[model samples]
Target chain A: MKIKTFLAFVGPSVLAMVGLIAVPLIGVVYLSFHSSYVKTEIVEVKSSVPLFGGLTKTTVEKVPQPVLDENGEPVKVWEYVGGRNFDTVADPGGLVAAVSKDRSTTEDGQPTSFRQRMDGLYRDVTDIDFWGALEFTLLYAFITTPCILVLGFLLAVLVNSVVQWIRGPLIFATLLPFIITPVVGSLSIYWLFLDNALVASLLEQFGAGKIYFLKDAISIRTLIVLYGVWHVTPFAFVILYAGLQTVPQDALQAAMVDGATYWQRIRYIIIPHLRALFSFIILIHLMDAYRIFEPVLVFGSNLFANSLQYLTYYILNFEDNYYKAAASAILTVIGICILLLPVLRRTYREQKGVA
Target chain B: MAMTRDEKFWEGMRWAGFGATFLFMAFPIFWMILTSFKVARDAYSTKVFFSPTLNNFISIFQDPYNFGPLLFNSVVVSFSTVAVAIPAATCAAYAFSRYQFKGKNALMVSVLSSQFVPPVVVVLPFFILFKNLHLLDTRLALVILNLSFVLPFAVWMIKGFIDALPPDIESAAVVDGCNRFQVLRHITLPLIMPGVVTSAVFGFIQSWNEFLFALILTNQKAVTLTVGLMGLHTDKGILWEHMAAASMLIMIPIFAISFTIREYFISGLTMGAVK
Candidate 1:
């Protein structure tokens, strides 16, 4: 009876998840393997109109359109004659050979091996959307994660006080950066580096000329990494601050009485006590950061700072390339899963005991 | 909490640091507000002082931008998501919290892990599905997409809250000839109302701030405020003052909501992490 009732209670949620998320995800994988195809279809066209003659012009013609299936559906039809979409992205020229410089020394003045030619091809390749995006994604994740941890720790420690006079407003102030839309929040940072803005003016005052931070690829990437740290630190600060409250005061007092400085007490008692909290924070941050998107949009770094998520959007929106988009989306999902494996393992271990 | 001479020095230094940190934190918002009020000619200048005008606000609400529909869409989408997701999440959360069914752990783990899947991956299938159904540019699409993220978060958070409620009340109602439905309606719902509200607010904000899915799913008619802010970037370069005004309008309500619900904010965000 309880089992029947439980299913009734939970049925809607499970149904919704299975319908939207699970089914679509499976569809993503299925669709990724099949590329779009255009099949010429014969069609009958008839038209009548009054023309120069009183007989009224009449036209009948057979035209060709893309073929539809039995259900009048296009079926994507699986095309690779133009090019395999996924290969153009994830494995561009994977099976091809090309030389760099065309001047490499050889007795016959020709490249000797496909392996050498491929190596030179790789050297000559300056940027590709999929690979650059992956690079930016990892760089953003690694740099921002540590920055949030350290900066959030400082903010937490800075504001964690017995004095209530200033804590309230300070907490509210810190929350502003986080509470804004991610697009607008990143834009706020991006705008500051534009010419005639305050930050740019400050740079000019300090013997630097007018500079737009979004101009260069490196600066664009730097702004994104910096924007990420600025945006995510509030979350870390809030979590760590909550964790700090859980520390036992007597332990800290005992350490203080034993001649431990504030730093020493925090290093020994506080950090050790808050280790679980740190792991939880890290887990949340890792999952969120690995799927980073909107910041790249505001940073205007389409040329260099595209994240994997951004690349997925780019593939579909600009390329009109659904086949490759599905493949990239699947690749991104795999990347997220790999990143979260350790966190998932820990959660599974804990849940086993709960069970 | 006793203070010594050395500790006093550190305390003073700490307050000073917080003062600086507070300024750093608040400066962008200060500038945003400052720009919103600045006259157009003075917007690009570095001068801190200028005569202010409210024309930017009124002008943005005029033609070509038409932010009114976008704001309406944001409200409807966010509220509709919370409305749907909250009840569904509550039902699931209650089940997870109250029962020990087989594979309960597995179910919970799967639900929680879904939260980590990037919106882009999710958006891919949604884009195709919505295109076929002619659901694009409708508030329903945003609500449905919002539910994918907000549902997992809401379920986890609501479950955590429900977990803290005492079992005695539920069991007592059950003993008093109450069916599971009756017990949930009579005894459980009232007890967990605060959690439900907190979860609702969190879900609301998640949908409100959601960018990727909305950007892809809606072109003009059902655009949310988060995307509408982008429309301010015209060919004549970004209208800094106009964006500032639009942004302030975008942020103020969420700020008000966050401030009012400030107490439960962290607990809701971290979900079970704090416990």
Candidate 2:
């Protein structure tokens, strides 16, 4: 009786998720293999004479090519030849024939050629552009994660010491950077740092030439890292600030009473207590950073500085290569899974009470 | 008795450190707002504290393809996503919190893990799915996609909120001959109202600020503010003044929401995952 009730309750949600989420997810997997094709249909009219020389007509038929392939061979094929409208047939002893070609079949009516089965899974995993984008994505994530963590920790520590009256406004001010959309954020950075702008102007004042933020590979990469750090650090700060608030005051007092230095108290009392929040924030940021798209797209709006995420966007939007884009996206998912494996495993075990 | 000079010196250093940190954190936003009011020429000048002008604001609004529709799109998609997501999540969350059932733990974990799935991973597949369904380029398509991200977080948050509520209140209603629907409407919903609001606000902000999905799923009619901002960086040059105006527009709603529900936003960030 309990089992039936549970099934009834869970059934709809499971079905909805499967139908809306899982089926499309599966379709993405399917589309990664099959090439997207466009089909055009044309009809031709023909005229012929009946046996009694009375007027009769027949519709000529032609199929351009196979719609679907079987074992990598065209299951249906057609031969089409061009001619002037009814001119050849009007001439004496003129004839028209529609022919078909099956490349897999030999002249002796034997299937001599071997065709390979469609390996969608293998192709989805092995696309070249996908791998390049994967590498760039990892590098971006790795570089930015630590920067945000350290900067956030430092900011949180500083905020923790502010007077009660000022803390509220100060906290909100610090959070403003993160509240804006990343698209705007990256554009702002681009405007500031692009050639002859504020950053370039400042550099030029110091005897430096105008800096092209997105021109060179190294600078563009650097810009992306900086942008990622700038955009994401506020999120880390918010989480760390909350975590800092929860640190036991008594423990800090005890450490101070033991004549430990400020840094020492932070290292032992504050850091240890904030481990779960730190891990949670880090995991979230890492996953988010790995999929860095908008900033890269906004800042590196051009051909160069295309990070893996941006590359995926370029492929999907510019190239219109859905199969390759799907491959890249799949790789990105795998990269995130690998990065998050430790935290996910820990959560799984804790939930299951296995450790 | 002697006063220690070292202690005073360290206190002074702490104050200096805080001032520097505050300045660092606050300057970008200060600059953003400052640039929004400057004329195009004055914006490029390095001199500080110039007379401010409203030219940027005027230009942003007077222009044909200004921030108007993009802002409207953001508002519509965000609120629509929140409206759909919150109710669906509330139902699922209530079941998870109140009922003890098989696959309960698994379902929760799956929902949580969905948050970890990179948006890039789903974009391509979702693009194909939407295209096949003829949902591409529609506002409804964006709302549906946003829900996938927003719904999980909403569910997790509402579940946490519901878990914090006392079950005895509902039990009393049950004892008074209330059916499940009546008890939920009269008792549970009212009790967890704050949680619902918090979840809705969070979902709205997330969907509003979400750029990746919006950049991919939307074009032309449904072009959101975020994607529209990207247009500022064309081949001609980066339009700092116009971009700043747009940035200011996007930040206003999010800042308002964050400030209003400051405590709930903090709690919602940590949610059940941390504590």
Candidate 3:
């Protein structure tokens, strides 16, 4: 194919991506360094105050008036702030103070030990909004990745080992949690744990105490993690299930002939064959779990736990700070790149080999 | 082959695991569907047996809760995004598959990396741009934004399919005096139609279930079904029954579409990462 034909074929897609994705990403980076606000100016206004019958007094007051455009909408002015937004979001100064304070002594006036100092630093950094969100986001990623992988592998193995007649229905049933909208899926889980809902009522009948599942931070976070596992396990199962098909039966048969137990054969043969897929699932899961937004919203757990994505969104919507949101957005992107660095390097090496 | 006593035990355990897994996975969806048909009181209660009602579904489409427009918006936005993404992706995928060009690997890598970009980062700049252009809360804005993620996915998935094909037919057509476009339309496309449909359904699912972009980019006029779920939160508190009904509206189509393409679902999701 000629270069012209190739260009023509890929032109629209390339253009759309550049215009929407590449350009917007660049704009986010640029906006991170700048601040925008509705331009306002101080102006004097005169008002007549009615006195007792026909008498009136004039008063002059100064007020700030938003500078409006031809369309009567407030005009916005953008000025470079040079990382002020980043400073506000990160609070490095406060972090330093907190660390230094913790390093000095305990409340009993005893000298702080190395372990205590490190603990203090951890607590201090996480108290900051940026670090706090990052901590939970990483926690979600770390916790859910292993759970999804193990459960998904087990599921794949089970589904694979099942009789042919029941496989179709099993796969169809399993795909429901995954195929449902994230919001709806989370909502479904959320409802079950409500005070009067099925799960809660069942627990009540079994003499378990009435626990307000959404009332506390711990339970809410647990629900979020549970939702992640329930939703994503199918993805891992499907991929690993596909990988299972390619596993050589001779290897398994050989192990069986050697008097290997089921666990032993799996540990030696199946896991080794699916090693590449394990990393693949981990890589994708890490990228997705880091975002972790819809569940946070659906669970109404933003107050208790916020992901990096949610932090940026909260700043933009609740705080009405686009500059700060942009700064955090850039930081979120950086965080993902760092999280994905090892997997990406491996993938790059493989691609090079294939090429 | 005869199983040992231990093997029988393991076999029983596997069946038990399968049953447990099936129940754990299916119970939530079953509960949701059941709740959608129940009255508000029954939905709130733990009683499994109750007289079911369709009133929740009817009420969602009526006054105040008027989901009719939101449903319309979701359909239009999802269909429009897929309609635009599929053709462009097909062309790009064909080019990448057949042609060896300069900077091809770099371009492909960029396309692949773009998928990992969190939507919040993408939406920030778009929100500002749309606000400036008065395009916020419009379906056009959504269709355009959805393309950013959808088109790249479509390209990768479609490219995987095209690469898998023998390409002898397309080459033969090209040699027999059919132009590149003619050959692509007549030969290559017909062969890759299944793959293209899978990508289309996958893209549609992405758009239909998209929450953040729909949340941030739209307010009322263009709210998609996923974002429309938030409206179920009333001043009186969340109407659980109505929410279940709304959820049904959001997921039923997705479940149907995905079930149809279940065979290719994994391949589509992995987007050429796996075979």
Candidate 4:
């Protein structure tokens, strides 16, 4: 192909991505450096008003921006704080420094105990809320990825085994969770356990007392993971089932002719055949689950069970701290990158081996 | 044919598992649809059967929760995204499928990995830019952002289809003195029509169901249906019936579309990884 033709073909999508995705990504990294804080600086501004009879009035209004102080000064400022925004959520050294700065205020101030120092540090720098979300984010990613993989693979095998006539209906039914909107899907699961809901009533009848699924952190976390699996497994199933189609018929038939049990055949043949698909699924899940947000939004309140995505969002939405939100957003990217390294390394090695 | 005891036992177990899977998948959506048809009082209770009324659907559309605009926004944004993305993606996909260029693998990986970046990271910049341009709450801004998402997947997916198609016909067309563009128009496009439709449908679904972009980019005027469901919250508590009604409206069209393209679901989703 001519270079011009190639560019013509590839240019629009690339430009769209660069303008929309790449530039914005660079913006997040750039915004992470400058801290938004209240600063007091006097500034002047021009103003204009349309008066009666098509006349215009222009005046310098004393617009006291929040970065400026009282004397018609700006009170808020975008201070270039370097990585200080990152220290708010992470930065143990910064936490210690914050504690040391406030040691005099630590409970009577006479050689504060370790616990007191830690508590003070938590207050000063370590946002427990963000850390809590980080913890749950990891937990959700690990727990739900495995659950969805297992269920999806299982369901795919079952669906393939079913009578051919029913396959279409079965596939549509299985994909329902995936097709439903994520927020609404999570709400459906949450609503199932609502007071006087069918599941709640059934649990009572089953001698397990009506459990308040939402209020209890453990149950809510489980509910969120369950909902994740319910929503994502279908995608995995579709992928894995497609992989299964590529399984060598001769090999399967040979194994079937022998006395190999179903489980044995799956373990020895199907699993190995699915190794590439498994890796792809893992990469997708890790990339997705590390940035978990919708479940937290729909199932758990940001007050208690925020994901890392939610943590960044809370910083932006409530605190309106763009710099801090950027820092958190960058941190989230790093977390996902860390999770992605092993899978990427494996793919690289496989490519080299192929070469 | 005489079945052994072991075979009979396995048959029952398999059917049981299938039944369980089916119920698990279908029940939540079934409940959503069922609840939307119930009256306010009966909606709350765990009653097996409630007098079905079409009131929830009618009420939500009429009153404060005017979903007509939201639905229109969704349709416009989704269809527009597909319209722009499909052709652009097909071009890129054709390039990837036909040519072996420098940095081709890297470019493909870049497309794949774009999916990994959290929407929050991307939304952050778009929000500021849109605010600066006074384009916030505009469907145009939403469409512009939606392109970033739909383009990559569409490119990769259509590339899969074009790759699977034999190059023999195109080569013959070239031998007949047809240029690349003519060959693409007369042969390549007609051949890849199913793949195009599949990519278009997949892109539409992704754009339609996208929540964060819709939630953040647009507000009252340009609310898409997914985030519009969240707006149904009232001061007292969640208006469950109305939300159910709204949820159904958002999902039923997706269900119809998905069922129509059920055969492509596996291939379109996997982007030809399995095939």
lDDT of 4 by residue, B96-125 (tens): 778776666667777877877888999898
| Cα lDDT for residue B30, candidate 1 | 80
- Top DockQ model: 3
Q: By TM-score, who's the top model here?
A: 3
lDDT of 3 at A82: 97
Q: Candidate 2, residues A110-129: lDDT per residue as tens digits?
A: 66433311232223222334
lDDT of 3 at A167: 75
Sorted into a CAPRI-style docking class, model 1 comes out as: medium
lDDT to native, each model: 0.81, 0.72, 0.88, 0.83
Q: How well is each residue in A8-79 modelled by candidate 1, as lDDT tens digits?
A: 988998888877788878877776776766777789888998877477877999998877789997655654
Candidate 2 clashes: the total is 1
Q: What is the lDDT for B166 in model 3?
A: 79
lDDT of 2: 0.72
Q: Whose DockQ is higher: candidate 1's or candidate 4's?
A: 4
lDDT of 1 by residue, B73-94 (tens): 9999999999999998998888
True contacts preserved, each candidate? 0.64, 0.44, 0.72, 0.72
Best by lDDT: 3
Candidate 2: segments with Cα more than 4 A from true spot? A1-20, A36-128, A206-210, A301-304, A352-355, B1-3, B233-235
* Tens digits of lDDT, candidate 3, A1-355: 8889988999999998888788888989999999878899999999999999899999999999999999999998989999898899888898787767747688889998888888888778888888888888999999999999999999999999888898766776787888888999999899888777888888888999786788888888998899899999988888888788889999899989999998998899999988888988988899999888988887777767889999999999999888899999999999999999999877766666666
TM-score of 1: 0.89
Candidates sorted on DockQ, descending = 3, 4, 1, 2
